[model samples]
Target: MLALTNATVITGDGRTLLARATVLAADGRITGLRAGSGVPAGARVLDLEGDYLLPGFINSHVHGVTFGPLFASGAPPLAEEAIRRNLVRHLAAGTTTVLSVDGFALPEEVAEAQHLSPLTIKTSAGLTPAALTAAQAVDGAGLTERHLAASLKEQVEAGAVAIGEAGSGHTLGGGGSEYMYIPRRIKEETGVEISPAQARALKEAALGKELDPAARDEAALQAALAGAGLAGRLTPARAQALIAACVLPGLKPARRSIAEAAATARHFGLPLIAHTAPPSLAAVLAAARAGTRTIAAHTNHDSFTAGAMLAAARALKRAGAILDGATFDSFGARRTTESPANLVTLLKAGLVDLITTDYGGGFFDPLPLALKAIVGAGILPLPAAVRLLTAAPAAALPGLAPERGRIAPGYIADLTVLARADLARVRYVFIGGRQVFSSEVTSGITSSSDV
Candidate 1:
């Protein structure tokens, strides 16, 4: 048995607290959580000097791409190793679980390129995107399509648990408005013109190559929607495309999205994860209308009134759907709050359903999740910040809410020991009942940047 004494236990399970308390864990699961005067007998006690013992964070939408900053040029990075490093980094930041997507170098050859470079070089200076220029940095490259699929399958093969942040819902130009409108002249001067007709033709061709006759047909339809404006007017092509893509925002039918996400989930039994921003509400609602129980990673950014939230909730309810919350990190110091605090906005609206980090947000740590709650959500207490991250999402996903994300009896041993300085702090961290990181270890041999 392992016992931690003198720790301020934040049992993320909604208001359960143990001041200067002791926690016991056995067999990698929390066996006991309560307030006691001294350490339990026969337990290996680790003395914590009034630090916070909370559930390890579960970030639902962190990107492997965040490491792109650390990488330069060379071969595609070592994805698994980079992921491990990121996991360790998240651990140090009090995050125990993370959901990663995108920024993996594609083309199966990139994986081989990874094996060619030094661990530091490959892990930091990722393998370059072939068929491109040399000497430029773009964070991390995405995994080859085949490799991403294989990686997902590998998670299954390796008995790693599944959590979906698929990020497949929206494409680059799909957002339409608010995207940096690169007018035709810039492309023309660069000899890179993305004509709607050409884009349509290419999409049609790609669809035909997909072998899924239905999707191919849908792709052709999507091309048409692109050619015509999404909201300007519904031309025949727009109607047909909407029918084909089946993912039009607001008033769109939900068949296409339903079919696609269902196929993905069946293959992996993973949940459909949707990232809903203020503008993407309509499309997200359309998806929910299609009978998908998706995780709404960041539906917290709701616009005032029911125009957005109501449409989505109604559609989701009609489809018998549920979703998860994503507390996205506010841009560094741009916003007053951290990400998790954003929950109070939803919570005040009585929308506190599912909550998780859009982990590996543009900023660092689960602390942002907590800080956002205080600032964005107009909250002041630290305990409340803790629950939004731990309990809310736990109630959403299985094998999670009750078992992990908190300091409690009969819970998973995964926990984060954090030192606080107003909004941010770092002393040491523990994961799965082991001291996985310490500032002391990070001090001598290596710079803490990679941790």
Candidate 2:
């Protein structure tokens, strides 16, 4: 039994707030909650000192936090140590549940990861024919005969909650091409190396943002080559050819897979998460129109201008798609999606339905820090901002722990205690009424004797 007293409780419903409340928990469930509730005689009590207490966060679209098929590219698994470290980072970030949208991990792999961590980890499946072909085209080194032979129905029956992350950047001329394939191919062929941004500029210049072959511009391609340090070494045609080889082979197949994936998701009564960047937006919109419950992943992809992003959001909403924004190293590395401007635009327009941290090549920002940005900008109130990481995601993915995203009585006591001055400072975290982490404790000793 535990009693958390004197906390400003955000109920995770985007509105209800309790001032200086006491939340009592026993046996992993919230036993009682109210203002000035007296602690029972034998219960342990922890004073919050008027700090903010809320439901532990639920990040529905995460990646690279498990020892499984890495990404939609079906790359090799990350080491067990790395997977544990990533899960610990998430635990300390106030996240209690996360859906690994890597899109190719098997249910058994997810179960294995769950056995290794305290966090509740869920997975989505992607075993469509086109998805596999696309993965094979790029990097299927991680996949085995079991993965290749597994059907979506079998995987879902084996406990995969959803179908998604289909047609990813690795196969669709998005982040994967810029960061991994384009640079690798360019360096192997031409000794000069370029950054992901430079690669993106070159690809856009040659094939345009839509990856259309006919959209190539000779002058733009020449300028991009010079900018990327390929000026004298290769002709415009050669540079174009290099980029085409890296992106075009799997582009059409991956795009075609979106519709197939959506149909499969619909048949299974599962939500479909699809890549929603400039290159794949059309296909995603088409999937949404076809009546699949579609989640437009990363609508704020840096490739879009403010206008383009807003327009895309509007179109997706019109097509009955749910729009999600990712804090992809935006505040720290600025590697893939450079700025949080698109997120701001989405929030200001009330276009975003959920928020997540898409793995920014392992530099993803914490969910609380993203909420800090939102609250600091006055884009949303603290409660509303917090909802995107809590109730919203829980509602979006029903297979997620639906009872854990609120502070109401009878709910699972998955709670996060945060400092009022800095929302990102996670002081303590409790999952299912068990105190799993505390900032004041180190090596079995409290940092302050007063604690």
Which candidate gets the maximum lDDT versus the true structure? 2
Candidate 1: regions farther than 4 A off: 41-43, 65-85, 102-145, 148-258, 266-269, 278-283, 286-291, 301-323, 331-344, 359-361, 372-384, 399-402, 420-423, 439-451
**Alpha-carbon error at 297 in model 1, in Å?**
2.1
Backbone clash numbers for all candidates listed? 29, 0
The window of 10 residues in a row where model 1 has the poorest summed lDDT is 118-127
lDDT of 1 by residue, 1-451 (tens): 7777678887876676678887888787888766763544566766666777777665545544232212111124445666556555556666655444332333233244323321111110112122111112111233334432343344344332232332222221121110111223223333444433333333343233221224445455455445533323434343434223312221122223333444454455555555454334444455556545566655554222335554555455556555554544443332212333344545555454545544322333355435543544454355666776666555555533346777767777877766644335555555567665666544222112222
Query: Residue by residue across 1-451, what tens digits does model 2's lDDT show?
Result: 7888888999899998888898989989999997884777777778888889999999888888766687777889899988988899889999999989877777788888998788999888898999988888777888999888888887788777778888888888888888888999889988999988889888998899889879998888888888989999888788888899888888877888898899999999998999999878999999999998899998888888889999999999999998898898897688766788888889999999889998887778888888888998899999998888898888877876778789988999999988888887898899998888888754122222233
Q: Where is model 2 more than 4 Å wrong at Cα?
A: 442-451
lDDT, each prediction: 0.45, 0.86
Q: Name every residue pair that clashes in candidate 2.
A: none
